[model samples]
Target: MEAFLAYTLVVAALCSYANSQLVPAIVTFGDSTVDVGNNDYLQTVFKANHPPYGQDFSNQEPTGRFCNGKLATDITAETLGFTTYAPAYLSPQASGKNLLVGANFASAGSGYDDSTAALSHVIPLSQQLQYFKEYQTKLASVAGSENASSIIKETLYLIGAGNSDFLQNYYINPFLNKHYTVDEYSSYLISIFSNFVKSLYGLGARRIGATSLAPTGCLPLARTIFGQHERGCVSSFNTDAQQFNKKINAAASQLQNQLPGLKIVIFDIFKPIYDLVANPKKYGFVEATKGCCGTGTVETTFVLCNQKSGTCSNATDLHHSKEASDHVSLKQFDVLRYQQAGRSRFLNDTDKAVNSHRLLNISKIPRRRNGYEHQENNSKFLQDGTMNIN
Candidate 1:
């Protein structure tokens, strides 16, 4: 009987140790880049819960992720030693004990600006925050008040925005562009980003990370439409993205200075993703300017790339482009017949880097509370307790 009691105690101790996570919880907010499946429940066309989407994920099933496999955030979670992902806020799985692990409030086709999400009838950033608040209440009910307070305070919050603001809204919306210049629109978005962070801080979030925009001009669809005549990256669009990154960096610093205990960092995805696009050979990607689906030129969303759509024999070797602008306001094109297109890798190599903390640079970020400043080439933030805002 004594031996039996000892065995039970040992088992209980082991279980308790295993339950202790790196940061207690991970909360995410963003667009399709980090959206797991929130859009699946929404009546939006910006979903990826179909074939060829998750062809490389475990179980070979689409989980509404926009990637061929695990998203960057998914890999980040795994790196942090999480066995299960944070359930999407709208999914049925986000209940009971699952709330303790945290929740994903991202929706595909959403952005920093609510107008951007409205263009596609998707959940806006403001709505996602409201959902997060609801999740917090449910979490407190499940974990109790004191435990839930610790979880919310220590949770690593990640947010991604801005991509759809430019690609899906401002570029196409004449009214938006006519009212504000591109720089002015970017400033407006940054103001929104600032308020969003402040709101999260008010709700007990301390650590946050934001991701910078990828090389938008190099995306296959962007190249096809804007750079068709040149067969090169649209310098104008990339310049806009670079300018936006600069503004975000400045904004992050200002936020850190203002928010007493907040630890914020901007993950530099621009350089890493651009490296993959510019020097595909360095990363073993043969074609960087085209996608693996359909004609490899456009075809991003569901209506564009169905099972009938000709997909490359191996998506592992190819990249996927951003969503096609098939909004009802614009004239739509006839769906293309199946055609064998060349494959090129996207985010695959970067996932490995993220696991090792190589490409996730937190350069030029001022660590105010840490009493140090990040150099222009440091990746120290990954080891530290800074969360990313995308």
Candidate 2:
């Protein structure tokens, strides 16, 4: 908890420079990675409103986030000095004054491809945009047209997609895989992403940040299904993710150049997450190949990782007694917490660059190279004790 607090403090301090929040509001759209609770309202099988899902969240109440506690975006909210999260757009909480701080239009299984969301009966990217338009009307009603316009122009827009496009759609859907090769599929997604950003720009958004795809093959579900006899991170899947990231990053740059007064940043989530997965011990985790809930091998969505599913114990405590050690079954959230802990290790320099320049325009920020590539050469803590951002 100390580490978490210290991490939070660093972020708070970064955004708190000049005695104000970085932006007036934050509007988010994407999949489960950023979905707060919109899936709870939807009649979809891809929900996370159950036990062990939000065990570390406030009041231990599941809020439809596919994790044990606050998401990285939740921490982003705190860092920006928002007293409350941008309420899920479909929730009752997203009305009146709540609309002023933006709304989360993300769904649990949605992605850049509308068909990806269709597979799970969740809201598609196009529908989420329609909801965003509706939200603008609501905001105008509450905050007035002029203030609403200002907020719309200044709000930090965030989008996290691509993961579901690959994991939930391409991998399983034979039709998709049969048609497009990896590069072709990624290019297709980039086209969708480009259009999405352009649509947002047209809707009065100026500043946007989109998350790059994580090392998808390293995910427990992927490891189980596709890791083959070697039982390791699938290099093919990771390569696909890297290629997609390259395309998206290029697409973001092109979009920025095409759209006047637009500032776009492709947040490099892949490297940090991959680093954590590769070197779990450096980030205070004992397990990296499985999730915390259920069998931890293949369970990810609602039914598989549900109330009946067995969760791993927090057995990696320093106490190391029989009681403590017996509980050792490391999982995803264990790594997530420590990933948060380790962010402070290198985020300081990165945050400084972002804070010093325009907060939203972080495209040119030169990040430190923490050596996950050479992790085997050193102990858990690198000689410099810094986490690298790729």
Candidate 3:
């Protein structure tokens, strides 16, 4: 009996050691939903460079993130056992150590088409990819080709951009972008975006788990704009997202064939989102329409949503801040399809119910606190006292 117990303990130790060795570092690309802070490098107005953006973040300063708390990349990285995301590709603060973990190249308001739409202060899809290339070179310098490939192999390449293309082309900018109606547009986007996947595969990205667009109509921004403040989703935009996913599924199928030892996976966020809204008890959410901070024509993502100078300060308080319009509204295209299309979908205002006891149960050191920073200082330290956010 004693020997058997000892053998079991030995087996457990091996499992732990093997699990530790397999943890991989991811390098992310795409738009604001996953953008750690790349917009900080650009001069455009599409900046989220303020307090509230990251107020709830582990660091507690707008790291140029576009969510009340963690970005999709943050949650996904955490789920995959990564220590934490590497800084934005443009952050001068990033070091060799940081880059090896992962780097976010997403920018607010970016999309698949190079010339799809025009946003005053957003990164174009092509430019975001350029930054990705730069990150690859930098990683290569630090970890060498083999080590870099190892990191890339373990990383989950999440691409959450697309709706911005529609916003820039179909909605706000009346240029009739993409040359298709909503239904046709989704198909066109899928075709155009396939090349992007191909490009990443060529760059040594082996494992890709893309976030399929969610219900676009359900975004706060769409609700505000589509029906003059009516609640619920923008069916047209939502349909567009559905169509986009169908294409993504098809494209991933083709890309899988072309690449060797490569995998393309989809994070199915659409049906889940709709189901969450339709049946809040299952997901522990209520009030899916209004944003926590406030609402308006632009909803709660742009200037009004800032944790600093916006009407009501929530994302941050007693921290550095900015003025209205100073913070780039990530609320635009990111609101729902992006999962926010606000892209930061997993989190919702329902979490802040004043009297409702209902809450979404979770695991982690939440990246946000009145003053808290989120990260696995070391992956091995997970579940240790230091990792508890509050």
How far residue 295's Cα lies from its native spot in candidate 2, in Å, is 3.1
Q: What's the lDDT for candidate 2? A: 0.66
Model 3 spans > 4 angstroms off: 1-23, 116-118, 177-179, 296-304, 307-390
In order of lDDT, best first, we have 2, 1, 3
Q: Which candidate is the best by TM-score?
A: 2
Q: Number of clashes in every candidate structure?
A: 17, 1, 20
Q: Candidate 2's residue-wise lDDT over 64-126, tens digit each?
A: 776667765676676577899999999999999988888999997899888889898999888
- Give model 2's TM-score versus the native structure: 0.77
Candidate 1: segments with Cα more than 4 A from true spot? 1-21, 299-304, 313-390
lDDT of 3 by residue, 1-390 (tens): 111111122222222323434346656666656667777888776666764566666667766776556654554455345676668777885668788877777776677655542454566666667777777778889999888877766565657667666654467654443333566556555655565666666666665656567566765556666756567677877777777766776666665555565555543356655664466454334444544454434534443365434534433211112221111222211222332122124323211211112223333222321112222333322222121112
Global lDDT of model 1: 0.65
Q: Is candidate 1 or candidate 2 better by TM-score?
A: 2
Which prediction has the highest lDDT against the true structure? 2
Q: Given candidate 1, what's the lDDT at residue 239? A: 92
- Choose 2 or 3, whichever is better by lDDT: 2
Displacement of the residue 17 alpha carbon in candidate 1, Å: 22
